[model samples]
Target: MMMRSSPFWPLFSQGIRHRVLPRSSLLTPRRTVKTLPSFSLENKTCVVTGSARGLGKEFLTAFALSGARGACIDLSQKDCEASIASIASQVQNAYPDDPVPELRAYECNATIESDVKSTWAKVVEDFGKVDVLVTAAGIVDNVEAENYEYARWRKMLDINIEQGHFVLAEEGREMLTWHNIQGSIILIASMSATICVRPQKQAAYNTSKGAVQMLAKSLATEWGPRGIRVNSLSPGYMKTDLIKGLLENEGKELVGSWERDIPMGRMAEPHELRGTIVWMASKFPTKPVNPA
Candidate 1:
């Protein structure tokens, strides 16, 4: 048999071939392997918006349980303190031996771009760097389209779509790129983006969520090559204070109506979304999940 050089032989020991791979080729291409990354948030720093209550507060607890330092960014300082305390208590109860992950609260109005930027800067200053960003600040306007005023519609878009979602994505991308950190950004969208809710009309809220879903998809395409992942988690109705008033007014009838529509037969709890949130923020190999 005659001897011939094989292309794959480059993978062999350099001592044998007395050859070195080009720096670009060595660093650019990664081997494709099937292995799940550890779903641990140990020592990671996360910045979460709208952490005062509801799903945002639940995320804070999840972060604490996963051993992540967190910055709870909400509109009210008092509310943020309450959220931080809640997370701390959960960590103490769950992992008594382990030191509770640091949790700080920042009063930030996400609707203001300057406030968002400053709050993120403060988070970076305190935590060294942010490993994950969660945009969870939002509001729902369940008013009839006919009665919806121009100001209300604009305000809804301003807060729900632009400040709460777009601004966070922009700032997070900047931070990730600057730090050269392969981080994840999770935007909170809603199932209403895909399906209109019955018995109530929230056109502004639905439209805002739909826009968020699209924004996340667009950013995923733009940022995937840069090692930063952007994903939008669109959750169904959840049992949280955000919708408590409406739930109380409608009582069991509306509850039953929504439950019948969903295969789960019930609304999700705030804690129910924690696992998915952790997975998204983990080192797992996850592609950008638009409307996830």
Candidate 2:
């Protein structure tokens, strides 16, 4: 037997009510469910500058692994072809049953505007369209700012900033015209753009990379409404041929000091950035959401 409580209990609970809900309703989610966005680059055509070697080749390999048909652009056609062949072999081995994506080599001096235009046109002719473009053709040098030669400084800016801009512009024209295919453009900047690297002076390189980041921001704003996404990838120190050479020549002690400063206590491998490159090239949301 249960004892009755005070009648005031009902009065105190006037604003509260309880109702039994169906088990199915209780189990159901309130919000609509959605599937995850795919990162596969199937049926996509990609163009990568500096694809002959180093980080550029790594980026191209990432795209290939994602099932993208690619055009490898570099200063030497032979080198580009060799890189593509290596990539083809790797891709085939990875996807033993699947056919390797078509990969072609293209030669172009990115610093030259006319050369960039012709090479991009040829790429479009061969691949029909470019869905993604990664401008990785750049060089770095270490020299004290005061002693840096004017010619060397000019060359640095020409190759990194100017060349990247021209190649990006040409790709933009191709994407905007012809079939008006919306595309993604990735500019490979550097961590030095944000922070001054120590133990070595690369004022020109850092400045150019900073400009590359700014260029991406400006283009993203200009082309966002047009369905093109432009972004810059600023990578920290990676173990590439360039960095390897530096470590060997600059002495292990000096380079090792910098390596110790890294959060991981070591330099990143080239393959570590492959996922990032693939994600950038793949279809994903590029729009900014309003907080309001």
Off by over 4 Å in 1: 1-37
Kindly report which residue stretches of model 2 are placed more than 4 angstroms away from their true locations once superposed: 1-37, 288-292
- Top of the candidates by lDDT: 2
What's the TM-score of each model vs. the native?
0.84, 0.85
lDDT of 1 by residue, 41-89 (tens): 7778887888889898888788767767777878776678777777777
lDDT per residue as tens, model 2, 76-187 = 7668767887888888788666666777777778888888876776677556788999999988888999999999999999999999888888888877876788888888
Deviation in angstroms for 15 in model 1?
A: 61
User: Model 2 reaches what TM-score against the true structure?
Assistant: 0.85
- The local distance difference test score of each candidate is 0.74, 0.76
